[model samples]
Target: MTDKDLRRAVLDELDFDPSLDAGDIGVAVSEGVVTLTGHVGSYAEKVEAERAVRRVRGVRAIAQEIAVRYADAKKVADDQIAARALAIIDWSVHLPKDAIQVTVSGGWITLTGAVPWRYQSRSAEAVVRQLSGVLGVTNRIAIEPRVPPGAVKDKILEAFRRSALFEADAIKVTVSGDRVILEGAVTARAERDAAERAAWSVPGVRAVEDRIVAMARADKMRCTAARIRDRSSIPETNARGTDPSGGRKDTKCSDRGACPVA
Candidate 1:
């Protein structure tokens, strides 16, 4: 599609989404890349606006320049945001109690401490980002690598083979200590995301370097756009996020609990 056409599509998608007020959001397209500017009322709405743009077909990449602006009456104190963040995290059954630490400054939350799984860290950020007055989240929750490097590689490859989104042979996985490096190319952006998610699901993956490229395919973009639109109507769920390869199982820890490995 031409840049002009893509720009219109993005604007329409943003306007169609009722969860966010798109009046202040600006859309600009060059080639297939989309750039979002201006500002929004909340961080969640800012995120929703970007997601709305991604739902449009022919959008290869997005440059998010949207700022979050809160009304004075709706502004929340940093200490309050911190307190609410801690309480919500403590309430989540998916996260180990007291395993994550919260720090808030200028309405942005910074998470520290350690967890046994990537999903726990991700869940912590997800829950906190939804709280009132949150500007952004910085998740520094480290993962405790429990399995050997070889087992990590094997588990990731097995996950890829089991998923319909990937051709296991097309992607290569390299394990160095607790870090994983993935290099390959897939046809759609979603596939590349799935590959990285699969690698992080492994037990010993402390970090992942995603080198997989998504080749531009008009047909795939159209299909993904349709799915995105369909999903936009569904109410958001708070369950632990699911990956394309079934889902990752949480590792069982000893009575003492999984401690952060220095």
Candidate 2:
């Protein structure tokens, strides 16, 4: 559909009175993908607005470019990065407690958070991405940095210790300040997922940037990877997924199946 048609569709579907007026919401549509722009007060509001647009018929994908601006500049600097980060985490329904930290310097943003699951780290990223005026993000989040390197060797090792997802000693793990990088050849997709989960579990980590090369022994990687789920049940599913019969088209996957069914 045309961009105007998409904007009008989104505007019609969104019900909340955003902190800002409807005119402030910038809508861009190209090739059926809709992007929401402009500013809001809270990340939750920004998300609801996106949901509104996705509910409209003819929407294929959504790119949320909504910014969360502070009520006042005085509130910006006064809210320390760690404080702001924690507050964001505390306020978010999806983020976990005792898994994240915030570091800000002259406007630069650094997230130091950890979680047992790689998905949690990803959730933390999404949470911070909506913050207003986030200059740059230095993700120092790690997965399982608690284990001794001499003992664990790599993420695969740590994952084995915790979740039994992969070999304990097969994966290679390295830490450079806030970045925890993982590398190794694995036989299955679960092993890769385990490595990523371990990397994200470490405290004081910002980003578990992985560079591991997969060496699937059998077709397990191919078979298991297909079972990986994208969205979670914590956040309410976009009703757009289900048709009148509460059934959605099997082919209606996302750009990356990241938000399958809408």
Candidate 2 regions with alpha-carbon error over 4 angstroms: 1-3, 16-21, 42-44, 63-68, 71-74, 87-99, 106-108, 122-262
Please write out the lDDT profile of model 1 over residues 205-228, one tens digit for every residue: 889997765555644344343334
Candidate 2 C-alpha error for residue 189, in Å: 25
Top TM-score: which candidate number? Answer: 1
Residue 5 in model 2: lDDT:
78
lDDT tens readout by residue for model 2, 1-262: 4668767767766635443255567887885678888876655566667756644656655788887655655244625655666777788776677778887775566778566545566677677656664544566776654455443345434455676656654555666655666754455434565567676655445566665444324432332332232232332234675334233222432222121221
Q: How high is the CA lDDT of each candidate model?
A: 0.78, 0.57
- TM-score (C-alpha, index-matched) for candidate 2: 0.40
The worst-scoring run of ten residues by lDDT in candidate 2 lies at 253-262
Candidate 1 overall Cα lDDT vs. reference?
Answer: 0.78
Go through the candidates in order and give the clash count of each: 0, 21
